[model samples]
Target: MVQQRTADRDGTQQKANHTPWLEWVASGIGLLLTLGIFGSIGWQAFDDAGAPPAIAVDVTRVVPVEGGYRVEFRARNSTGSTASQVEIEGKLAGDGAEAEIGHVVFDYIPGHSERKGGMFFTREPRQESLALRALGFADP
Candidate 1:
């Protein structure tokens, strides 16, 4: 009986020694994976911080002419970057209402300028200077 008990004890010790160390390894790998995901998110946040803001726009003038209205405009990048494919909207403000009369497109270089001509509009006969609203910027 003592020999049989000793054999059982030895068998128990053998099983304990063979315990799966892979579980410990897997746990460490999981920890590393979690840290990697968090680090990636943090890196993305930092990158976004350095990115420029949206474009800013301005309208210099809109004046009535013989055949049409002349539109003079300017666009600026407040984010300190070059803005391209810009769409500017001009509106006429008169007759108790404001109406979008025209749209134009141009590229605004960063810290520079672009001038456009041939802005024409047809107005009703005997009309005076039309009130104008102008909005300009790079595409969203």
Candidate 2:
């Protein structure tokens, strides 16, 4: 009976040693996966760091509203960084004369995204030469 108890004790000791090895392997794999995920994210951020902010303005539509003409436009940001305080200026010209001026401001424009806004002008923009330009932007 004593020999049988000793054999059982040896088996239990072996199982205890093997269980820790499995636990260590699992912990190592989890740590490696975590590090790999973070490393890839950091690499992508560094890769996009050099891209400059490029903001563009496109007038989509112009409709006459109650008080003025609503100039629907799209603002596109083709950069890696976010832009803040984005301002767009619009001018309506007819026969070499500026008829009206309007402007719109966007609070935030994220990188690789587009935002829509409108400007109001007293004159009908369809009859005149409408010029839309990006005034300025600040880094967010």
Candidate 3:
């Protein structure tokens, strides 16, 4: 009986001393994966924040709305910086004279993105030669 008790004690000691190699490996792998995910997110944010600012405006279409003519346009940001208070001006000319002028403002436009807006003109913009210009932009 005493020999049996001693054997059981030795067995318990051996189990307690066993190394959890698999658990350690799994924990390390989990930590690495977490770091990789956070690193990718941080890199993307850094890349976008450091971009410069370039703006382009294109007059796509001019259609007459109920009250006035709506000038459909697209604004594109090619630089790495965000633009705020983007002002676009439109001029309509007929018979070599400026018929009407209109302007639109965009609240915010991020870098490498495009936004659509419109300007209202009291005159028929389709009948006149349309001139679209990006007046200016403020840093966001």
In order, the Cα lDDT scores of the candidates are: 0.56, 0.85, 0.83
- Candidate scoring better on TM-score of 2 and 3: 2
TM-score of each: 0.40, 0.65, 0.62
Rank by TM-score, highest first.
Answer: 2, 3, 1
What is candidate 1's CA lDDT for residue 8?
100
Quote model 1's TM-score. 0.40
- If the candidates were sorted by their lDDT against the true structure, best first, what order would they fall in? 2, 3, 1
Instruction: Report residue 115 deviation for candidate 2 (angstroms).
Output: 1.2
Please provide, for model 1 over 1-140, each residue's C-alpha lDDT reduced to its tens digit, 9 standing for 90 to 100.
Answer: 99999999999999988858898899989999999999986876665434453544454666888776666555554443345666656555455545436676765544233444334556431225333222444533
Candidate 3 versus the native: TM-score?
Answer: 0.62
The candidate 2 region of ten consecutive residues with least summed lDDT is 121-130
30-98, model 3: which lDDT tens digit per residue? 999999999987876887667656778888888879987888999998876788998888888766665
Steric clash pairs (candidate 2): none
lDDT winner between candidates 1 and 3: 3
Candidate 1's C-alpha runs over 4 A off are 1-49, 96-98, 111-118, 122-140
